[model samples]
Target: MSTTTTAPGTVPAAGTTPGAAQGPPKSRRSRRPGLIPTVVLLAGAGYCLLPVAWVLIASTKSSRELFSTFTFLPGTGFTRNVADLSAYRDGVYWQWMLNSLFYAGVGALLSTAVSALSGYALAKYRFRGRESIFNILLTGVLMPPVILAIPQYLLMAKAGLADSYTSVLLPSILSPYGIYLARIYAAAAVPDDVVEAARMDGAREWGIFTRIALPMMLPGLVTVFLFQFVAVWNNFLLPYIMLGDDEKFPVTLGLYTLLQQGASAPALYTLVITGALLAIVPLIALFLVIQRFWSLDLLSGAVKS
Candidate 1:
């Protein structure tokens, strides 16, 4: 038997060609495309967060320090700013906060309820003109709220509801987008056989909906509520047009009024910044509280054998 001696650098692997240039694996190379999305996401996040950071830092500054200091630096006037804001107009800022809470909370709840009913009906029922109705709602969704603000104000004026909380609340309660979301969610989240079984057990339509369907739809409803709450909370034009009385103004309009006044009285600028900072707290809190509900998968046990 003859023995073959291989040179030190000339040994080939089992299948690879000898003297082939070794390179990184294909998987690592594929990950290079992900960097673009990551860069885009970081840029987007920075764009969104930069204003919030400026607001937070600016709120801490006194009027004199606000312009003198660096834009991102924190100052020592947050407490004083709060005090001045509270003292303004006998604490009307708190009233605006409460009005905003009422409008957002009540309007979101009512909108979610209406969306739930409308969505469930649209998903499960085979009524005449149902698609047409949903298409109309889609059209409403496409129509900007700014466009409707004038007509809504006029309607409220004709009905003697202008300048009242009811005007804001009523218009906010019927959200076409909310209804559309609910319809899509219901069709996906709910199983048709479950409804048939409930009906076979002699359950009334309302009972079946409340007891069975509602629980399954809770996550979607929460989303609708959150969206409507944020929309109503941040609304300006509708309230600005509908309300002449500053007393009924939601925080958004109230802040705008403050901003307008700040042009004349620069001291109110600090208050406006402080109020703007405070305005976002409830929304943050609400998102924190509501996020846990979204994790629940309620449909898992609905059709167990």
Candidate 2:
């Protein structure tokens, strides 16, 4: 009487056939997704994208096609739409674009710098009133922009600086949320021993920060910069109230005025939509460009460099 061993994953010598000998029947759990979550997620994505999708499609249509045709289909008027936008008011749209760049670029750079310094200080140092200072800045985060904008406008007026570029750019530079993010980043990225090593080499505190901590904190700072950039770029009320001149308007306020006019003209509706589409183009482009450089882990301060 000879016995043989079966190969792995094969049926054993039970008193049954190959398919049935190895094990009991496997359970047939359903692999399909439940209806509710799938529907909810798809609905959310559609809700978020419907406006954006509409803008992209609408920006391609002429004023006539915009009203006459179905909403979702692309049109042949993209070139003409861009040309008309380019030709509008001696190309004031370009000026608004430039103004938005100036406000967001300058404001975000300054805000990131201040947030870095303040955050580094709070994270590393143990000076008197440190907690108090952080708490005060946190309070600024809770304060509504509506509340601050009025007082800021009043103060700028007293200083004879209302209706100017400075009035728009200056107030936005001190961002409490940016500081908060910076603090979290600094605490995580920066190490005590590195600062101690720098100090041992006779490096000043500012030198250590500029040379050592900043390089380590760069990834997180990009997030602050990007956040503040979008915030300033999209800001309408501050620039609207502070700057009366259309030439000084950022794209948001500028497009808003165009929309107001469109209420009567109706033709300007296409231009307004076109301008909005153009305004968002750079943001999408910037995200794609910086996405490679951004270390998302730095947002959580998980990186140890």
Candidate 3:
């Protein structure tokens, strides 16, 4: 047997043809983000965070120093702002906060439940006009909530629910987007064979869903809950139109009123800023608390085909 003598480094390996051209060195290829993308991301971050920074800084400032000084400078009035906000109209700010929590909390829970049921049915059950129904929901997802506000208001007025918490809570409970998300998530996360196995074990539909499908779909439902909660928490238009009672107003609407009043008084601007800053705390805390649920691996021990 003749052996092929190979020169060090320059020789081809066993399979490669001799004198084959080599590609460029790996070190020459750049893996870092391009300058333009980096710039764009930085710009986007600044655009988003600048307002938050301003809110934080402004919230710490008193009304006198709000505009009189530099924009980003921190002031010494944070405690005073809190005190004034607490003292404003017998602590009505807290009432708005409580109202927001109610709307967002109750609305998110109900919406998530409806979405879970509707999505699971649409994804798993084959029925007549299922696609049509899903398509209609997609259309609803496309339709802006702003456009529906007037009709919702009209319906609520007709039902004598206008200016009540029920109007806001009821409208928030049926989220088309949440349903859409749930359906997609169910189709992806909940396996068909697992469902069939549950059926073969004589598990009722409701029991299978509650026991098996629900655990698998928990992350998606959490996402839907977060979305709906944030939407209702930050909602301004629907509540603005549906409610005339300032006492029932959510934090968003309450802040808007303070903003409008600030136009004349200018002192209320500090209160508005302080209120806006505080309004975001619950959402942040909620995200931090609920994020752990998303990390659960519920499908690890799922039945394998």
TM, every model: 0.90, 0.87, 0.89
> 24-95, model 2: which lDDT tens digit per residue?
665544434466679999999999999999999999988889989676989888888788888999999999
TM-score of 2: 0.87
Candidate 2 collision pairs: none
lDDT: worst 10-residue window of model 1: 296-305
RMSD of each: 4.6, 4.5, 4.3
- lDDT assessment of candidate 2: 0.91
Cα lDDT tens digits, model 1, 24-138, are: 4678768899999999999999999999999999999999999775767699999999999999999999999999999999999999999999999999999999999999999
Model 1 segments more than 4 A misplaced: 1-28, 296-305
Sort by lDDT, top down from the best: 3, 1, 2
Question: How does model 3 fare in lDDT?
Answer: 0.93
Question: What TM-score would candidate 3 get against the native?
Answer: 0.89
